[model samples]
Target: MDDIAAHAALIAARRPRDARLRRVGVSRAGTPLWLLSLGRGARQALVVAGPHANEPVGGATVLRLAERVLADPRLTEGADATWNLLLCLDPDGLRRNEGWLTGPYTLGRYFRHFFRPGFREQPEWLPDGAAAAALPETRALLRLQDELKPFFQCSLHGVDVGGGFVELTRDLPGLDRRMAYAAARLGIPRELGPYDTLYWPRLGPAVYRIPPPRPRDLAAAITEAAVESTWYHPHRHGTVTAVVEAPMWGVAAVQDGSPPADRDAVLHAVSDALRHDTRVLKRLLARVRPHLGGTPDAARLLAPVDDYLLVCPGLADAWDPDTADPGRPLPALTAGHLTALGIAGRRIAVRTAGLLHQLVTGAGRDPSGALPELDGLIDAGCAAYRDDSGARWIPVARQAEYQARVVLAAFELAGRHGARARSGEPDWGTQAAVPMHRE
Candidate 1:
């Protein structure tokens, strides 16, 4: 957190006349949230970094992106867009994840220090009465969104282990293809399987359309709330919202589109593994419930576990052949896809155990009597995941570069489209001839 603050300060200081940095709001922990605004164009482009606390790659991406745009006037001038960059949306949660920020970048180390807020706690996905009820960080972002009403918005996010992918609220012509090509240039494989955004419609290779909200029940409503903010910007201002998902670790399997020899068996096995991990997490949570004090932080710590417990069952059920519709065949299940699923489940369990271990041993507590079970669970889970996934650590700089290119691509697409609309030109479905930035 200090490093990010210092970097932001340095960036602002470097270009004092043009770069404007100010405190937007205070986090739940009283940490100041900063927004750095640059450029002087008619259209506004908002780039939010580190919306998910666990995904710290965006921290580097935002800093580098700010520097790139500030140095290259053509980027801002040609795009005709003023860029508003938020360094980190969830500082309080991010502080919890700082242990692994400067790291060996191994899967075990990453999972050991991992800290992801529950869906409800995420700044991007606030409920209806967010102004009063949501985290101060979330409210700050909402205020920014309302104030900027940007024509282009990109939320920088990443996965622990998988091929890179991007999700767009609107299919902005050739932007998806361009972003995928950029990531590919960086040797980041396009995620071919349905890993994170399972039901979202595929717009192109490694590009997905963010699914629209369709809430029929409370659970569905909660899920919708988690993603509603992505649509909020677009629905109000026709903003082209792009979610850049870079992977921390690259799995060659995720790039392979071939179906497993026995697809149903693979799916069922993945489902069984997830179910088992869910059960383990539930048991661990139950054991730690007594130690958790009556505090908001404690609730925050427990929320992800509760969310996993709630959602994992349905997710596991969906993988069952008996439950899936026969008419709608399942997508190709690659070895990498199955590995990603297994790793995701183990990640949840390990993270839950990690947090629980912190609570039990934190605050000058005696280490000898602390919960050994929690430590064991975390260590075992991390080792199992590391050994099984066969995932390679992707450098932070590489991930940031890939994400920066994606953001730039979005900018070019939006600028071209806006220019066309202004001249009363028809919406020609031709691709934008934006120059790619090679490292």
Candidate 2:
């Protein structure tokens, strides 16, 4: 959906006249915040896609869901929820992603076009204050949630590598079974321990349960506070907030079930990489900050790293694999997870360097002198990402279909009045039965 207006028009043509489209507010740059709505059922459900322009996997899934529901209004018959569809929630950032959206959806292409905001400035975690209220997109979402009080709120997001995983407010019954089936059918693996050591309530290989954020966690630092925007309001507790994380590139190593031989070693390696990236990026950023006034997308690029450099050390300090439910098997990762972990850190440095390069060129300066060592770092990181991403790419349409299936299943599972399924008792203390993937 690079040409959002064009896609929006196509969606409008498919849906009935009852479908509504309007600008809810304006983006920071004055781009209209648009929403499309269909169904007037008693229960309200809101689906958000492109919450982060860098993660575009859900863009097609959201559109397909809207199209299906439009063609057969009964698609949501049992759920009895009015669906508010918000696509490209951050068009200002998304437009910056157009360079890679139309191409081969490779990891490198994605990183090249990425423009994620800082955790605090992101749609989900924007600090609640006068400044936040002034953010038209943030305000519009808050207004809609307050007005509708949705029964379900799901934000669509994706990852750079690995497989698919779902995050829900509560551990619902039978959702795991459906999620596993959908991912297997699509030939994608699950991310065993995503970003944080969140492997818990092991419903299945890829399906996971995410608890509500605590006051302490939010207070610890902004990194801990980067809760989904849906959590900002009291109405959120009663609602089923789900996050679907699909990956751009995946491999067999992604789903390795075996535990690492040295958990401490693996944890330290990734944490060190993250911390190193933060320091390196911070130094480069200080040099580039004064010169950013001339770049086309300076703010978009600066926000992520500015926040990242400040909070990364805290995140690394808190890493603990022992806290995860050992009994529940992780979907994938072993040695490969270490590589991916390092790449995540490298991407941050690469992104900052690319932006600095842009700013320097715009200001008519030679990049080598202005941003010494940046080109080498970016080039080295990119070479590593390419080496890892090779032969691991999936078609965007296939990824969408699998995501839609999992989401639809979740809708049924989370419905208040809809048929509920069996809840499996999890064995929280035991070693994983499956072996890890080792080359």
Candidate 3:
């Protein structure tokens, strides 16, 4: 958000002269992909940002981290590892969001300028199938992975609002405590609801594991994994993938501890909401069917909203209610998570609905009333998003700092975990308070 190119240059200028910046690959749009490397230790780690264009907070965080490592060799000092940080992985998509990067960031402005890579298009997800590294940017990352074979890979991402949390492939001991403390120090609450736990195991209050996707043979990959895909997790087993989900808003709400709603009621609401979303999407698609001739990546554009209505809810339904109950009088933070989900759901709807409106209204700078049946729905959704008072835009630098702290802790934890792993120690996934660094 804070001029990624300039920041990259700044890192290059300020970094210890021994640190090296190398062009790893290029994005589809010809943006040069770069990695800043330092410390040639035995172990290796890869930190990436801009995997999702909409979540550039991670990119800023990664840049800040480069500064920290360069200034104090001790940050990565004792931990014997080589680090390669890829700044802004999806610059092509990020550029699409640059309009709002310098903003009086309001709810409306953020969504209007938003665009996240779909599952199939995401670099992290693509490596699983026939289309491995299909995107030029993805190929660059894959090359980096092949060359580095990192013991850890972290994707920096921030959520719209809820609370701060982390998703890991294999649970690392004591990392949860570190994350909770990081959130506290940042003055953010840890999300308590099972929004994510519906899919992954809750390690601690806010920390979760990436839920393994439904059986790979579940007829449809997109439909199945749409809800909870650990595609990035198992890509290189024994390697850990860590994600930091910081919130842009929903600060006080996260601390709420109210009793939740009934499980049945939540399921009903989810099914009904998604079914409605699907139906509206179908109608909009039909209306604009003729106009979609040769639109680039139209299918990919539609995959997310389609998956939202069909596969996503089915996965939620399959959750064991006795063990995982996500619906409730969600504490302020939990409720904020739900509110964020609803708003995100509608963003997809609006994206498609807007296109439909454009087509019907002649789809140009000066158009007529093309929004026939969808007008009220679009208007109502906008009002609902504005109603959530928990929304606050955390400055990019603040978020980056918060994220940077978590990562440093992760590096130490992972180093300890790796050292234990090499010694044939018990899985750290379930262990607690073991020595942080055994090597």
- Highest-scoring model, lDDT: 1
Task: Give TM per candidate.
Answer: 0.87, 0.81, 0.80
- Tens-place lDDT per residue, model 1, 172-279, is 678767876787688887676545655556666667677554434445544333245644544456576788888888766666655567777877887887788777
Clashes of each: 0, 6, 7
- Inter-residue clash pairs, candidate 1: none
The runs of at least 3 residues in candidate 1 whose Cα sits more than 4 Å from the true structure, single-residue gaps closed, are: 129-133, 216-226, 293-296, 325-336, 363-376, 420-439
Residues 57-85 of candidate 2: C-alpha lDDT, one tens digit per residue: 77788878877777666655545667788
lDDT of 1 at 102: 72
Q: Which is the winner by TM-score between candidate 1 and candidate 2?
A: 1
Indicate the worst ten consecutive residues by lDDT in candidate 1: 430-439
Candidate 3 lDDT over 294-377, as tens digits, reads 555555455554544455444444432332336532223344345434444555565555444434443332222335555665
Return the lDDT, model 1, position 249: 80
Residue 345 C-alpha lDDT in model 3: 51
Which segments of candidate 2 are over 4 A away from where they belong?
129-132, 197-203, 216-222, 225-228, 232-237, 290-300, 319-340, 367-372, 388-391, 416-439
Would you give me the overall lDDT of model 1? Answer: 0.72
The CA lDDT of each predicted structure is: 0.72, 0.64, 0.63
